[model samples]
Target: MKAETDFDKAEKLYNQKKYSEAKVLFESFLKENPNNYKSIEYLGDIAGHQKDWNEAIKEYKILKNQFPKTANYWYKYGGALGMKAKSVNKFKALGMIDEIESSFLMASKLDLKHIDSRWALVMLYIELPGIVGGSESKAIKYSNELMNLSKVDGYLSKGFIDEYFKRFTKAEMNYKAAHEIGNSKITFQKLYNLYLNKIKDKFKAQKLKEQFEK
Candidate 1:
């Protein structure tokens, strides 16, 4: 009961964004209950919020090993690895790419409906060089998979890929499709950027900007 009360207090502190204070409590709780998954997960989240990617990776890796069936554990592990790779030297980043991809893949396999894992995989495939496992085809494949799961996300992902490749017209079409499906802030921002920067249409860009501002 004392441990539970302490954990609840730590969670409240975390939710209040008092990360340092929460970290101390969480660490104390974990010392008493080393196998408490929630405490480990929160510790990983706290490290992520602090941008201590290496520490986050360590915590998430432990979670993944201890709870191999939990999709979220693998997803968090992959995400931390991806962030750590981005923060490191180029040579080191190159070596970490495969591990990151594998972790994301494992997460996706563990839960077919895991949208975040699929989205991360799509971005990884799109961003990496061909020599290092980047494949536009794979990106498109994942985008299609997202389309099957969530229409809005699918269109947005496809639009992002198109814009990345400078296929402005196709990007506009996909972005418009996404906007029609759901006029979300992200959709509006993408359209605004497309009109303002890519198409150089100030009128359309201003309209979208105003809509988004509201």
Candidate 2:
């Protein structure tokens, strides 16, 4: 009961964004309750939020080993690895790509309805260069998969890819479609940026921005 009480306090601190304080409490709690999955998960999340990717990776790796079948654990592990790759040399980043991809893939396979894993794959495929495992086809494939699961996310992913390629018209179209489907603030923001930056239509951009603000 005392351990649970302490953990709840630590979690409240984490929720309040007192990450450093929360980390100390969580660490102490884990020392007493080594197999507490929730504490371990929060420790990993705290490390990631603090941009301590190595520590995040280490914590998530423990979670992955402890909960091999849990999709969320693998997804988080992949996400941490992806963030770590962004901060490293190109060669090192390249080496991490396979592990990152494998983790996301495992998560997706474990839970077909895991939208976060699919979204991560879409971004990964779009951001990496072809020489190092990125593929436009793979991006489109995941986008299609997301579409099958959630029309709004699918269109948003497609818009993101088109925007990346500077295909402003296609991006605008997809963003509009996503907006029609979900009216999400994110879709409006993307449309606002597209009109302001790529289409150079301040009027449309202002309207989109206003919609986003609402």
Candidate 3:
């Protein structure tokens, strides 16, 4: 009962974003209840939020090993790995690519409706060099899958790809389609960014801001 209470308190701290406090309690709880998956997940999240990627990866790796069927664990592991790769030298980053791809792939396969994993894959395919296995077609394939799952995600992802390739006009059109269908902050932000950043159409951006405000 005491252990459960301690865990509950720790969880509340984490929810409140008192990460340093929660981390201490979680670490102590972990020593006493080594197999508590939720506690381990919280520690991993705190580590990620703090940019302690190695610790995050270590914690998530433990969870994925213990719960191989849990799609979110794999996704968390992959996300940590991707972030770590970005902070390293290009050679090191390249070496980590396969693991990152495989982890996200497993998550996507396990949960067909996982929008984030598909988005990760779309970005990965678009960003990877051709020699290392980048493919616009593969990115498009995942974008199409997202379309079937959620129109907003589908169009946003497609717009992201177009923007990456500097196809500003196509990106604008896709973002517009997404905003038209979704009409949410996420869609609005994408369109506003394209207008203000890539296309540099200040008038359109102001117009979008006014409309969104109303």
Candidate that scores best on lDDT: 3
Q: Stretches of candidate 1 above 4 Å error?
A: 1-4, 211-214
Candidate 3: tens digits of C-alpha lDDT, residues 16-65: 99999999999898889988889999999999999999999999999999
**Residue-wise C-alpha lDDT for candidate 1, range 4-101, written one tens digit per residue:** 67789999999999998999999999999988889989999999999999899999999999889989899999999999898999999998988899
Question: How are the candidates ranked when ordered by lDDT, highest leading?
Answer: 3, 2, 1
Pick out the ten consecutive residues of candidate 1 with the lowest summed lDDT.
Answer: 1-10
Cα deviation of 156, candidate 3, in Å: 0.2
Candidate 2 residues 1-214, lDDT tens each?
4456679889999999999999999999999999898999999999999999999999999999998999999999999999999999988998999999999999999999999999999999999999888999999998999999999999999999999999999999999999888877777777887899899999998877776677
Task: Rate residue 146 of model 2 by lDDT.
Answer: 94
- What TM-score, computed on C-alpha atoms, does each candidate reach? 0.94, 0.95, 0.96
lDDT (0 to 1) per candidate: 0.92, 0.93, 0.95
The residue pairs that clash in candidate 3, if any, are: none
Clashes of each: 0, 0, 0
Ten residues in a row with the worst lDDT in model 2?
Answer: 1-10
After superposition, the stretches of candidate 3 with alpha carbons farther than 4 Å from their true spots are: 1-4
**Highest TM-score model number:** 3
List where candidate 2 sits over 4 angstroms from the true fold.
Answer: 1-4, 211-214
- Measured on C-alpha atoms, candidate 2 has an lDDT of 0.93
